[model samples]
Target: MSEAFGSVLWLIVAIGILVTFHEFGHFWVARRCGVKVLRFSVGFGKPLWSRKDRHGTEFAIAAIPLGGYVKMLDEAEYEVPAAQLGQAFNRKPIWQRIAIVAAGPIANLILCVALLWVMFLIGKPDYSATLGPTQGLAAQAGLRDGDRLERIDGRSTETAMDALQVLMLAAIDHRDVAIQASDANGHEVQRKLALSRLPADFDQQNLEKAIGLVWHFQVAPATVGTVTPDSASAGLLQSGDQITAIDGQAVRYWNDIAPLVKQWGERGGEAMVEVDRQGERLALLMQPRQQLNPDTKQQAWVLGITPAPRKAPEHDALRRYGPLEAIPAAFRQTGRMASDSLAMMRRMLTGEASAKSISGAITIAQVANATAQQGPATFIFFLALLSLSLAILNLLPIPVLDGGHLLYYLIELVKGSPLSERSMVAGQYIGLALLAGLMGLAFYNDILRLVT
Candidate 1:
């Protein structure tokens, strides 16, 4: 219950911050354009908290936390006094109105860049594109374990994250992706991955599994670090004990031990463990326990022994940058994300990608909560990504959105007059219907995810 509440709280905070900045853009632009601001609100419905400024603008926190708006004095909405007619939004020039309408999404994009800039300044964990295992397309392409990814197609990939981003788009389009990688001996080689074999119901989350590219990180030794209380290995295992074999099979890396123990546990069998304690060899019988995997939340075998920490190689670092470099990098990051989002959207529209990839409030809340728990830097990164997503989503040419309004304004600019009220009202109805269907699809995807 507490966890659920915490997720809700995080979601509310994230929405509130994003909405505030978004609405502020419209409010600020309108005021600068000589329009009379009526109410500046974060969220919709009844005002939860409100204050009227000396300028007669009402600032409000409303009941619904999903979205917000900056209401300005407009002749179309209400009767304007002759004296204040010049200050009405409807009286503003077409350019001024366009600027006001575009400001909200622009602010979100700016916020995304700002957040990324801060993130780079503070530094975040980084890793190379080291391969652990290759199967499917990757294996067919002759990608080997320990190979370091250099580039995808012509784009240089500095890290695994970069490669993954490229691969995701390539998979969606069923494009043949070219890659340059460094072998174990540091020899650069090129390979082409054909993604045509990927199933139509491709799961984005399991891209690595589908493409057969496992992320390789620093591997721990077989030495135990700490034992969990009342766990399967608590009594039988001790800190600093070096596990040699599992069920008479010799194990080298820590990853080698897990599957063996898990297989034994699933069949309710014991692990015939052999460990070297100090200089003495000892035979110990350990039984694995059924525990919920923290990530998958599925029943899995666990010995409850934390692996000893391994020092990260110098190559693996938190990529840090100064203000000057960070700003440019942030812009590039924002652009890259925006481009990727548009590509994914296009793929979905063309039926090359599943609509299930669309995430709703439930998924957003869960991600926000999970990222918040990871650390402040991670949470901030998540927020930046979300800000970009919000900006792009709002810019879609749909009715009842800023983009829709901008579209109408563009038409008015070209036609030398505003759209007729009857046409505008009909457009609004159509937009509402499209939006409702989209929302329903998103909700259905979210619920299906939970069930499956």
Candidate 2:
């Protein structure tokens, strides 16, 4: 219950920020275009809180918090007195109207970039672009464990996330992706990853497993950090015990000890663990516990101990940029995100991708909560990602959306007249229906995911 409540609260805070910026875009541009803004609302339905500005505009916080709008004086929606006719939205030039309508999504895009800029300055925790044990086709392609990924198809990859993004796109396109990697001895090697064998309907959820891209490189010691109370290792293992061997087998890292523990649990055997406690070597006999994996719903071995801290290499540390240097980096990152989002949408629409890729409020709330727990940097990145998504979603050429409004304005510009009222209303109905269906599908996916 507490977790659910925290998710809900974080979701509200995140949505409030995005909605405020979206509406502010319209409000700012409308005022600049000399349009009389009547109301600036963060959400729909009756206003929960409202205050009339000096210019007679009502600033409000409404009951609903999912979305918001900026209401302007338009002759089509309401009567404008003769004295205020010049400030009416309907009376503005087509270009000004287009600008006013475009500003909301544009603001979202700008916010995404701005957030990324700040994020770059603050830096992000990242694992090295190194590979663990490779299996399947990747291994056959000569990609080996401990090979540090340098570049994918000419794009420099500093982290696993960067490599995954490029690899996912390559898989979706069914193309051979060129990769440059450095072996453990710092020897550079080249390889090509074939993606033609992937199913046409591959989605984000299982992409990593499908592509065999695992980031479990051995970079940390196998030292016990904590022991869960009342568990199998409760009294047998203590924190700060560096495991040197298990069952007479040398344990070089946590990876080495993990499989041994699992092997012991599978046969219900005891493990003879040799640990270095301070300057003394201690021998302990411990039995592994059988626990269910929450994610995969499979039974697995558990040691009830957390790994000690491991410091990454300086070169593999988080990337930080100065203010001036971060500008172009943020621009490139945002542009790439926009392109990837558009490509994914295109694939989904073309039946090449699964609709399960679409996430609703529940999934988003859970993600928000998870990222919030990670730290401020991760939460900021999450906001940027969601903001960019909002920008792209609103820019789609559908009615009732900013993109839809722009589409109508474009038609008006091209045809030299506004669309007929009946046609406009019909388009609006179609757009609303499409949006409703999309939302319903997203909600269904979210519920389905929650259950299974």
Task: Score residue 58 of candidate 1 by CA lDDT.
Answer: 98
Predicted candidate 2 versus true structure: per-residue lDDT over 1-452, tens digit per residue: 47799899889999999999999999999999999999999989999999997899999999988888898998999788999999999899999999999998899999999998998999877678887767766886798878888999999898888888888777878888889999989999999888877776565587767777666553567888889898888998888899998778878677777788877777777868899999799989888887887988988888888887775534454867999998999999899889888988998898766788799999999999988887777899899999999999999999999899899999999999999999989999999999999999999999999999
Query: What TM-score would every model get versus the actual structure?
Result: 0.82, 0.83
Q: Per-residue lDDT for 266-291 in model 1, tens only? A: 77866588999998888888888888
TM-score, prediction 2: 0.83
Candidate 2 ranges with C-alpha deviation above 4 Å: 199-204, 217-316
Model 1, C-alpha of 96: deviation from truth (Å): 0.7
Q: Tell me the whole-model lDDT of each prediction, alpha carbons only.
A: 0.87, 0.87
TM-score of candidate 1 on Cα atoms, chains taken together = 0.82
